[model samples]
Target chain A: MTQPLTAGVSLKPQHYADALACRAEGLWFEAHPENYMAAGGPRLAWLDAIARDKPISLHGVGLSLAADEAPDEDHLAALKRLVDRYQPALVSEHLAWSMRRGVYAPDLLPFPRTQAALARIADNVDRMQEVLGRRVLIENPSLYLPLEGHDLGEVAFLAALSRRTGCGLLVDVNNVFVSAHNLGFSAEAYLDALPAEAVGEIHLAGHAPDANADLLIDTHGAPVAEAVWRLYGRLIARIGQRPTLIERDDDIPAFQDLMAERERAHALLTRETVDA
Target chain B: MPDGFHDRFLAAVGGDEAALAPWCAGPAASAGLAVYRNTTAKGAADALAAQFPTVERVVGPAWLAAAAVAHAADHPPRTASLLTYGEAFGGWLTTFPPAADMPFLADLARLDWLWTGAHLAADAPPLEATALARLTPESFARYRLVLHPATRFAGFDDGAPSLWQALQPPGDPPADLELGDAPEGLVFVRPGLDIDHRVIGAGTLAFLAGCGAGESLAAAAMDALAAEPGLDLSTVFAGLVAAGAFTELRTLS
Candidate 1:
C-alpha cells in the first residue's frame, strides 16, 4: 500500500544512495520535473530506484503557466510523459510566468495582478489539467517587485483560480513571508485569508536578504528561518495537515542534514494527525 | 490598464527601466529590478556551468561566469528544459574575443556536449561478441554493423579527444591544457546506466563512421585500411563489439 506522504525533501543527485537507503516514516521525495525530461539516462534510473521505496512528487519549475501566450506544447508533452512514468503522489507549479514570446527566462517572473491575467492564468491551468488528465496544485511565487494595477488581492485571485479550474493550491509559507515583507503586508493576515480547503500541499524553504536592498530574495540556500516557521505554524493551524515539502535547491547539505529539517515538518504533521 | 503589461514587464526585465514607467507605483523599483536582473543572469550562468563542467575547469569559474552572462544577454535560453541549454555555446565560444587565445576551449565544450548527449540517450541492450560469432567469417564481409542508440563518437584533427579524456575524474590533473599535434578520436557508449568513454584511433573512427553511414562491413574495412595501414582489423572489430558499440549486424541485401 502507498504510504500517506507527510513530509518530504527535494531529491538531489548527490544523495541518491542515502535517499534510497534511509527509510524514515512518511518520508517522500520531490524533484523538479524539468531535470528529468530526458529520453533515458542514469538520472531516470536513479529516480526509478528511489521511487520504488518512497512516494515521489514532480514539482515543475518552467511551465510558464501565466505567460501571455499558452503554455508551450512541447513542455506540456514532456511533463505529461513524466507524470505517466512516475505516477507521482502530487504535482505542482508556480502561479508565475517565466517565458515571454518564445524566449524563456529562468526565474519565476512577476506580473501585475489584473483581471486579464487571472483569466489568462485560469485558462492556462485548464489547458494543463486537460492535457495531464489530472488536477494540479498552483503555488504562489515569492514577490520582489511591487507594481501597479491589481484588480484583486493574491488570496482572492488564487481562491478564484481554484474554484474556476477545479485545481488545488500549493501554499509556500516562506513565499508568503517574503512577499509580505517585500511589499509591506501582514504575512499572518495573508495566510489567514487563504480558504483552508483549497490548500492541497505546502512548501517551506529559506530566503536571503538581498545584498543591495532591504528586500529578501527567495534563495532556498539556508535552513528554514524562524519567521517562516512561525508563518507555517500559523498556516497549518488553520488549514490542518497537508503534504509539506522542504526545498533546498542551492548550497545543499548532506542527506542527514536535510532529513533533520524534514523531521521537524514531519513531527508537526504527525502531531496534527494525532490531534485530529 | 494597458493591453500588454506582459510585454512591458518583459521589456523592463530586459533592462529598459523606462518601459515600466507607466506602472511604477513606488521609487523602490531599482533594487527589485536589479534583483530580477541578477536572478536571470545567475540562472543562465548556473545552467552553463552545470552543462559545461570541462570548459569551466579549463577557463576557471570567473571567466566562464562572465562569458555565460555575456552570452545570455544576446542568446537567452530558447526553451525551459535547461538540461540541453547552450547548444550553441561551443560555437559561440569561437566568436568570444577573450576565448580567442584558447582555441581548444570550443572543442572541449563540444566533447562535453556530446558526453551529455550520450548520457541522456535511450537505453538499449549492447551488441555482444557472441552475436557477431553467429555469422561465418566469409559471410561477415557482406553484412553491415548498426551503431548503438547511445553511442556518440567525435574525431578531432588534433589531440582534443585525449585532453578531454585525461581531464575526467579518477585521474590526476594534467600538467597543462595544451593540445597535442596528433589527431585523435573519442567514443562514448552506454549499454546500461554507467557511460564508458575512451580515446580511439583513425582506423576505428573510419570503421565507426562507415557503420554509422550503413556501409557494408567489407566497404568499412576498406575505409579503415585506407585511413590507417597495419591496423588490426579483427582486433578492432572484436573490441568495439565488446564495448557495446553496435546494436545489430545486418546483411546488406
Candidate 2:
C-alpha cells in the first residue's frame, strides 16, 4: 500500500496460481465483479487467496448504469458484498448500459450524451456510491456506431458526471483510441480534454480491426497494441501516474505473457515518476 | 431527445437499421453496428458453451457454437451473471430438430446444468461420518438430514447419466453410446475446489429424493427399500454420508 499505484493485469481464473505467485513489485490484480457473483465456489476461493497478498480492484462490466431504469438492486448488493469481502483498492464501472428491462446483452451498449441522459446516469452513479459507501471510477465506453441527439461530447459528459456525482474517471486509453478511430475523432484531442485532476485510474487493452469492415473492435483478445502503449505513456506523462491495468479477456496467453505486458506498463510508470 | 436514443440504438442493434439512420454519421456506421451485434452474439454463445460442457462435447464446439447463437436469439440472458445463464437450453434442445436423432441429448444437457449448479453453490463445511453415529435409533427416525448446498442428484430412465459420466474425462466419448433401457442416477458434490460426480443405483436415488424432500431418515430408508427390494439401506446411507453430501442433521422438534 505504501508504493505508488503500479501496473496490474486482469485476474483470469486460468491464471490464478501464477497471479498468487507473482512477485513483481507494486504488482496488483483486477477482476470483473460480475464473474465472481456466485454464492460460493472455487472462483471466490481463488480470489480470496489472491486478495490476501495483493491489492485487488473490482472492475464491473455488467452493472448497466446507463440503462434508463435504476441499477439492479440485486446486482448492486452482490457488488457490495464483493467490495466488502475483497476490500479492493479501486472500484470501477462503465459509462454504457447493457441491460434493458430484465434481459441483458453482454456488450457495453452506448447511449446518446444528451442532458437528460447525463442527469439519469449521474443519478445512477450517486446511487451506486451511496450503496457502496464509496466513490467509484466511471470508465469511457468504446464507441461502435455513432448516434445523434447528443448534447455533450464524451469527455465533457464524463467531466459533468464527475462534477455532479463526486465520482472519479477511469481513462481507458485503448477505448479512447478505438472509439476515436471508429467514430472519426482525434484520440489525442479526446485524451487532452479529460479533466486531469478528476482522473483516478487508467486502463489499457487490445483491439482488432473488423474482418469485413474498417472499424476497430475492442476485442481484448490480443496483447496491448503498440499504439495503445504509446498512448498510455502520453496520458501518464500528462496526468502523472495512476493505477493502470492490462486487460485480456479472450485468447488468453500464459500468465507470464500477460505479466510481461504489465511489466512494460510498470517500467513506463517508473520512468515517468523518475522524470517527474 | 436522449430518452429515445436507447430505444433507437437497441432497435438498430436488433437489425432495425432505419431506426438509427439519423444517428449514423455515414455508411461506416452500418459496419460498426455489425461489430456490436457480433460481439453480443459471441458473449451469449460463449456463456452457453461454458455452462453446458457436456452438450459441447456431444455436439462438438462448432456445432454447439452455432446452436448456441440460435438458442440465444430466442432466449437471451436475463442477468449479467452469465454463469447461471442458459437455464432453458436443455428443454430447448429437446425441441431442436437437429437433436431429434439424439434423444438423450436433453438429459445430458440437464446433467450439465446440474453440474454447473453444484460447482457454484454455496460453500459449507461437510458433515463427518461420526456425526451420524451419535444419533440413537429413536432419534434417527425423527431426524431429517440436510444435504450440502452443493449437492445435486437426478434420476434418468435411460443410460444418459452413464454417457454423461463417461464424457467427463478428457478424450473422445465411447465409440458405442447405445441408449440402454437401464434406469440410473447421478450425484454431484463439490467438497472442495473441484466438482465430483458419480453414477448411482435406483435405491440411492430414491433415498436422495426422500432426503431432498425433507423426509425423516427412517421414512427415507423405507422409500429406498421400496424402490429396490434388495436394497442395502445401511450401506447406501453410509456411502452418501461418507461422500460429504450431508451438511447437518436436525431433529424435527
Candidate 3:
C-alpha cells in the first residue's frame, strides 16, 4: 500500500483505470464518499481495489456541517462504512450547509459566522467525529454574497471549530482567493492569519470569472491561477508542509495533466520539509 | 446581529434582494446570489443527468436539464454529497407537466435510477457453477437462490425496457427503436466492476420476481413456466447464473 498521501488528485470515474495504473510517488486519490455510498456495485468494487494499493481520502461535499442540525444519520452511517472499508488517510468535509428541512442544494453554501452558527457547526462537527471514530478536516468554502449577523472571521471560526471538536482545517487557498476578491479582503492576509499549525491539508483549484458580475466563481475547471499558486507557496513556507491536493472537478484534463499539477505540489512540499 | 444568521443566510440564498444588501453591496448583489443559486441548482442537475444518461438522451439535454432543475428545486438532495441524491426525481417526473406527453418517461427514469443503484452496489462473488452442481432436484425445490447485492430487475407494462436496451452498446439507432406494445422485463447486475444488463421475457421476469419475493427455486420456476410456456428454463437459468445474479442459496422452511 502507498504511504499516507503527500499530494493527491480527486478520483473521477472517467479516469478510474488511469488512476489505478498511475505510478507517481506518494501519489494518492480522494473521492466524495457520497459517490461510494451504495449497497453493492462496481463503484465500490473499484474503490476497494484502489484503496488496497494507495492511500485514499474521503473528501465529503455533503455533510452539511453548517446546517441548522447534525448530519442525516443514514448519511453518517454510509460515511462510516467508507472510512472503515478504505481506512482513508484523511476524512474531510466543508464548513457549509446544503441540506435543510430535507431539501439538499448541491453546493457548499455560505452562512454568517455568528456565535450561534459557530456553536451549532461545532456541535455538528463533534457529532461527525464521534460517529466516524476519528478526527476530520473542515474546509473553508468559496463565498459569493456576504450576509449580516457575523461574530467571527472565517479563520477564527475554523480555529474555534478545531479547538471545540478536535477537527483540523483543510484550507482551500483558491477559495480564499475567490472569496477574498469577491468580498473585498486581502487573500494574503487571510492565508497568513490562518492557524498554520492546525492546517492539515491544502486545496488548489481553478476559478472562472463571472460573466454578469465583477466576481470570480470557484469553478474548479481550469488551471490553478498564478495568484493562488503564489499564495500556496507562501502558506507552505509558513506552515512547513501538508498533504496538498490539486482539484479539477469539471472539464477535466487527462490524468497526466492532473498528475503534473500534483507533482508541483509534491515538489513544493518536499522542498518545505527539507528546509524545515 | 440584526437577526438570526441562519435565517438571514437563507433569505440571501432564496433571493431576498435587500436583506443581504449590506453583505453584497450594489448592483452585483443580485447577480452574485443568482450565480450561487445557479451553481447549486446546476450541480444537482448535472449529477442527476449523469446518473440518468439514457433518460437525458431520450429527453434531450436541454429539456432534461430544465426538468432536472425543476425536479431538484422541489425535492432537493437530503445530503450534501450528491452521489446518492435525486431519489424522488423518477416519481416526480410522472407528475411534471412538460413530461406529460412522454407518459413512459417515469419508467425510463426508474430504469436510470436502478442503473445508478447497480453502478454503486457492493461487491459480491457470483454463485459458482460448482455450488449449483451440488444441488439435487429435490434440494433445488427446497432451496431459494439469493440475488446479488447489486442485482436489480423490473417488469414494465410497455416497451420502455426494450428502448433502454437499444441504448446499450452494440445496438443501433436506440432512438428509432420502437417500444413494442407488450410488457417487457429487465435485469441489471455488476459482476466485476462493470454493470451488465439483459432484456428478458415474461417467464423470466416472473421467475426473478418470484425469487425476489423469497420463493424457492422450483416454485419460482413453476411460476415462470406457468406465466409463459416454453421459456427454455435450463437456458434462462444458466444465463442468469452466468450474469452473476445469484450470490447465495438458502433452504426454505
Candidate 4:
C-alpha cells in the first residue's frame, strides 16, 4: 500500500538516528539524490536503514532539466540505480539548469521561459521520465535575475510543461514566495494558477534576506518565515493536501526542533484534509 | 538577440556587466545577478570545505574558503556530484602562491583526496582470516589478492603523513608541525562504515603498490624486500591482512 503522504523533514546526516526512531504519524523523509550518489558508503547505509521504515523522496538538485540539452546519461543512470534500489515515494528535479557544456554551476540557475526553451525542457523531462520509467516531479525554481525574454509567466510555463510531459509538479511554496517578492509579483496568484491535480508534492523551506539588496534569497538556512507559513496554509487549503516537506539544508537545527516545525505543517495538512 | 538569454546570463555571472544589459531592465538588475554569483560561489566553496577538512584545519576556515572560491572560478565542477568535485584542487595548490611557502600543502591535499576516495568506496564484506589461512603453501606464491575498493595509500619523501594523522582529530591543530627527515607511507581503508588510516613502512608501501598492479604474491613480496632490505615480510603482510585491506584472492594459472 502506498504510504499516506504527510509532513516530512529533509533528512540530514546528523538527524538519521532521530529520523529512524521517530514514530510521528505520517512522518516521511526527503533527501537530495545528489548527496547519496555514491558507489557505497555510510551515507547510503544510513539511508538504507531509514528507508526500511520510512518513505523517502529522492529530490534531485543537479539533473539540470532546463539546460539547452538532454539530461546527462550517467546522471540518469545513477538516479535510476537509486530509484531501483530505494524505490522512493517520489522523485523530483528542478526547472533550473545547472550545467552548460561540461562545467556545472552547483546552483539552480535560471533561463528564459521562451516557447523554444519550453519545448526543450519538456523534451528533457520526457526523456527523464522515460529513462526512470516513472513520472517524476519538476519543481519551480526561485528567480533572482530579472531577465526580460520570458515568453510566459512562471506558473503558465510550469503548467504547460506538466501538460506536455505528463510530469507532476513539486511546488516549493517558499520558492514561490521568494520569487514573487524579488520579481514584484503575487505569490497568491502564482499558487492559484497551478493545476492542483498536477502537484504531487509541496516543499516549504527557509529563505534569508540578501545582504546587499532588498532581496530574499532562497537560502534554506533558517526557520520558515511567518509569511511563507501563511502561503503554505493558503496553498494546502487550495491544492488540498500533498506530501509537504520542511526542508532545512543549511544551519540545520536539532531534529526535535525541526520536527516541531514539521508538526505544525502536519497539523495544518490534517486540518485541511479533515475540513475538505 | 532574444535567444541569447542563457549565454548572456552566464557571461554576466562570469563578471561581464554588459552581457546582462540585454536582459536587464536597468542597473537594479545587477543586484539580482550578484545573488546568483554569490550562491554559486558558496555552493562550490562549501563542497570544497567538506572534501578537504584536513586542508581547512591546516589553513583556517576563512583562508581556505577564500582559496576555495578562487579555485572554483579557475576549475569549476564539470558535474553536479560535488563528492568528486575537487579532484583538481590538490594539483592547483602546488602552483598557488599562498600555499607555496608550505611546501607540504600539496601532498597534504592529495592525502585528503585519497581519504575522500576511501570514505566513499564501494561496500564489501572483508575477506576473513580463515580465507587467507586456507591457501596451500605451494599455491601461495602464485596467488594474487585484490585490494578492497576502499583501500588507498601513498608514500611521501617526508613525514607529512604523520602531520596529517595528528591533525585528523578535530581540535586546535598543533602550533608547530615538524617535518621529520624519515620518509612516511600512509594507508587509508574503510573496512567498515568509518574510514581509518595508519602510518606504514616503505616496504609495505611497495608491497601494496605491487599488489595494486596485480602482481603475484611472490613478486609483491620480492618488491617489498627490495624496497627495504632485511625487512620482516611476515609482520607487514599479516598486519595488512588484519587491517582488512584485501577483499578477494585468486590463484594465477
Candidate 5:
C-alpha cells in the first residue's frame, strides 16, 4: 500500500492525462468511489494507471452514514472490493444520507443530529469499517437548514462517532465555512471544537453564494475563495499538517488552475509542518 | 425529541411547502426546504438521468427528470452508493402514465440498464482470435463459448440501437430521430476496462442468444440462420470471434 496523501486534487476525467504526467512533489489524486463503481470501463483503466504512479483516495459521496439504518451491505461489499483491488491509502465517506428505502438521492442530504441518529450513524460507520477492514474518515457535512432536534452538536456528534467506531475525521474546511455562514455559527469554533487527534485529512474547496439566499453554497464549482484559503490556513495551524485536498467537482478549470490552487494548499501544509 | 422530525423531513423533501413551516422560522426558511427538496430530487433525478441519458435525450430533460423523481420515490435507493441505483427505472417507466404514449422509452431504458450492467461487470479475458482459428471445422461445430464477464446484449423490435448511436456526438440528432422498423441487437463487452459496443442484426443476435444459452457453435449458428434465413454462417461465426464477444471456448461432451 502507498503512504498517506500529502496534497491532492479530485481526479477528473478531463484532467486524467495531466494527473498522470504531472510530477508535483507529494501530489496525489482523489475520486468519488461511486463514479468508478463500474464492472469495466475506461474510468477504471485510467484510475489504475494513475494509482500506479500516485497514492489514491476513495472519497465516497453516496454512502449515507446518517440514514436511519445500517449502511447497505451490497454497497459496502462493492466498496470493499474496490479497497481490495486498489488498496487506496485512505477511504472516506460523508456524515450525511443520500439514500433511503430503495431510491438514491445523489446529493448529500442532512439529518438532525440526535443521540438516536448518532447511534444509527455509528452503527453504519461500524459496518463500513468492518467491511473495508480499515479505519475510514467521516467528513463533516455542510448543513443547509437549521432544524429543531439535536442530542449533540455537529462537532460533538462527530467526536462521539469517532470514539465509538474508531473512524477519523475528514474535515472539509469549506463545508465548515459554508454551513457556519448558513446556519449562524462560528466556523472557527466548529473547527476548534473538533477533537484534533481524530482528524486524518482536511478538504479545501470553493463555494458559490446562493442566488436566492444570503448563504454561501458549498458548490465546488469555482476557485477556492480567499476566505476559504484563510480558513484552511487556520485549520492547518490548529490540526497540524494532514492530507489536504482541493476539490472541484463542477465547472472544473484547467489542470494548471487546479494545480495552482493545490500549490497554495501545499505551501500552507508545508509551512505548517515546518513550523510545527 | 421533536414530535415530527422524520415525517416533516420527508414532507419537506417531497416538496410540501407547509411541512417545514413549524421549524423554519425566518423569511428565507421556506426557501430552505425548497433547496433541500430540490437538491434531493435533483440528486435522485440526476443519477437516473446519467444512467438513462438516451432516455433523457429522447424524452427531453424536464420530462425525464420528473419521471425519474417519481421512479426514485417508488424505488428509493437501498444503498448509499447510487452507482447502480436505477435497476427498476426501465420497468417503472413502462407503466408510467406520462410515458405510456412512448413505448420505445421502456426499450431505451432497457438498453441503458444493460449498458450499466456491462459497465459494472467483473473483468474477464477475451478469447483470442488465434484460438478460434486453431479449431478444426468439425471441432468448431461442437465448441461451446462463454462470453466475457462484462458482456450484455438486448434485441429490440425496432432500430433503437441505430437511433442510440446516431444520438452520439458526431450524429447530433434532432429531438425525434424517427424510430424505424429494423430489428436491432446491441452487444456491450469490456475486454479490460473499456466497454465497447456494436449493433448486430437478427442472425448475430440469434447466434449470441444461443451461445448465451450454452449451445454449441453448430447449434447456435443453426438457430441464427433459422431466425434469419440465408444468413452468412461464415461471416456470422467469424464476427463473434472478431468482436471479442466470447471469452472462452470449450467442447461439451
Candidate 6:
C-alpha cells in the first residue's frame, strides 16, 4: 500500500521469482483466485512472497454472479478466505455467468440483460460483497452473439448494478473493441458512456480472430493489439486514473516482454498526473 | 423443460444449434455459438491436460483432448475451480469404450489424481526422525504413527505406479503402456515444497493403509509383516521416516 499501483501484469507461476525480485514502482500482479483456492501448496507460498513487496489483486473468474441463483456459497467462502489472507488491493468478477443448473461452463457465458435478470445479478453481487465484507468490481463481458430480449444496454445495466449495489467496474478495453465489432456498435462511444465513478480498474489483453467466424476471440495468447491500446488510452483519459492490469493468460512470453507492455500502460497512466 | 434465456442459451451452447436461432439471426448465429462451444471445450480440455499430464503424454494430446471433450458431456464441471476437476474421470474411463483396449489407463488416471491430492493437501511438519526410538515396547502397542496431512498413497492392481514414475523427467520414456501383471502401489510424501514419490512395496502399502485407518504402530506392523513377511520392518520404517511420511505419534492420554 506504500506505492500506488500505476499498472500491473497478470502473475504467472513461471514469473514468481522475477515478480518478487523486481523493483519496479507500481508493478503489482493480478491472479485468478480460482487457481489459488487450494488448502496448501507452493502456489500460496509464492503469492505470499510476491505480495509482501507488491500489491496483489484477486480477480476471480468463477464466482458466476450473473447466474439466476445466489452465487455459490462454497465459492464465496473460498473467495472470502483468499480476501482475508491476501487483503488484495482490488477484487473483481465478470458481468457474465458461467454456472447454471449445477453445471459450470468455463467461458464467461452471456445472459440476456432483462429487468428480471438485473434483479437476480444484483442480489448475487450483494451476496458476494456481504460474504466478503467488501465491495467488488464487476468487469464487462465480451459479447459474441447478439441475443434478443435485453432490458438494458451493457453500460446502462452496469450503471444500474453499480447504483443498486455500490460495486465498481473493471473495464477490459479489449472486450469493448471486440464486443462493439461483433455487435455492430462504436467502441469509443461505449467507453464514453461508462460512468466514470464506477470505473475502479482497467484490463488490457490480446485477442485473435476466430478461425471460422468474423469474430475476435479473447485469447490473451498474444500481445495487446494496437486498437485496444487506443481504447485504453481514451478510457483512462476520461476516467482520470485507475489501477490498470495487463493480462496474458495463454501463450505467455518472458517476464521482460510483459513488463515492456506494463511500462507502456504505466507511462500513460503517470503522464496524466503531470498534465492534470 | 428449459426454463428461460439462461436455460435456452445453455442448451444452445450445450449443442442444440437450432436453439441459437432465437438468440441470434443468420450465419453469425452459428459462428458465434461455435466460438462459445469451442471456448468451453478448450477450457475443460486444457484443465484436463494439466490434471492428467501422464495420460496426455502416453495417449498423445489429440486423443486426450477427444476423451476430455467426451467425458465433459455427461460429467461437465460442477464447479468453476477446475484445479480439482475430473474427480470421476478415473472411474469414468473404465466405462469409456475407447479405454477398453488400454485397460491400465483407469489405474493410471487414479495415480495421477492421487498426485494432485498430495500437491494440494494441507501443510504440516513431519514427525521427528527418532520419535519412536524412545517409546517403550509396551507403550508402542497403544500408540499410533499419524500420517502427515500432505501424505497420499494408493495401491494399483497393475504396475501403474511404476509406469507413472517412468513418465517423469530424468527418466527415459516408458517402454509401453502395457500393464504389468504384478500388483504395485505408490506413496507421496511432501517434506517441503517438493513432493517425493516412490513405488512402494506391498508391505509398505499395507503399513500406510493401516496407519491411515488409525491403527496402532504394533497392529500396523503386524499387518505389514503379514502382507510381506520378508519386509525388513526396521529398514522400511526408517525409510518412511526419512521420507517425511508421518507427522506425529498419537499417544494414549
Q: For all the predictions, what are the DockQ values?
A: 0.83, 0.78, 0.61, 0.78, 0.50, 0.67
Interface CA RMSD of each prediction in angstroms: 0.9, 1.3, 2.3, 1.1, 2.7, 2.1
Q: Which lDDT tens digits does candidate 2 get at residues B112-153?
A: 999989988999978888887878777768898899999999
Report per-candidate TM-score of chain A alone.
Answer: 0.99, 0.98, 0.98, 0.98, 0.97, 0.99
Q: TM per model?
A: 0.98, 0.97, 0.93, 0.98, 0.90, 0.97
Q: How far does residue A227 in candidate 3 sit from its true spot (Å)? A: 1.3
Q: How accurate locally, in lDDT, is each candidate?
A: 0.90, 0.89, 0.84, 0.90, 0.82, 0.89
lDDT of 2: 0.89
TM-score of 6: 0.97
**How many residue-pair clashes does candidate 5 contain?**
14
Clashing pairs in 4: none
Q: Compared with the true structure, what per-residue lDDT tens digits does model 2 show for residues A187-215?
A: 99999889999999899999999898888
Q: In model 2, where do residues sit more than 4 Å from their true spots?
A: B1-3, B136-138
Stretches off by above 4 angstroms in model 5 are A1-4, B2-4, B16-29, B56-63, B91-106, B174-176
- Weakest lDDT window of 10 consecutive positions for candidate 1 chain B: B21-30
Worst 10 residues of 4 chain A by lDDT: A1-10
lDDT of 1 by residue, A121-190 (tens): 9999999999999999999999988788888899999999999998999999999989999999999899
Model 3 agreement with the true structure over B1-253: per-residue lDDT tens digits: 4544455555776777667665555666686778877887788778888877878777778888898888876877666566677678888988899989888778888888888877777678888767888778777688998888788899898988888877755544454647789998889988777788888889998888888889999999999999899889989988998898888878788
Q: What's the C-alpha lDDT at position A26 in model 2?
A: 84
Q: Which parts of model 6 have CA positions greater than 4 angstroms off?
A: B1-3, B170-172, B175-179
What is the fnat score of candidate 1? 0.84
For model 4, residues A1-276, the per-residue Cα lDDT tens digits are 265879999999999889989999999999999888899989999999999989999999999999888899999999999999999999999999998888899899888888999999999999999999999999998998787778998889999999999999999999999999998999999998899999999999999888999899998989999999999888888889999999999998999999999999999988988999
Model 1: residue B58 alpha-carbon error in angstroms: 1.5
User: Per-residue lDDT of B64-94 in model 4, one digit per residue for the tens?
Assistant: 8898998998999988889888999999999
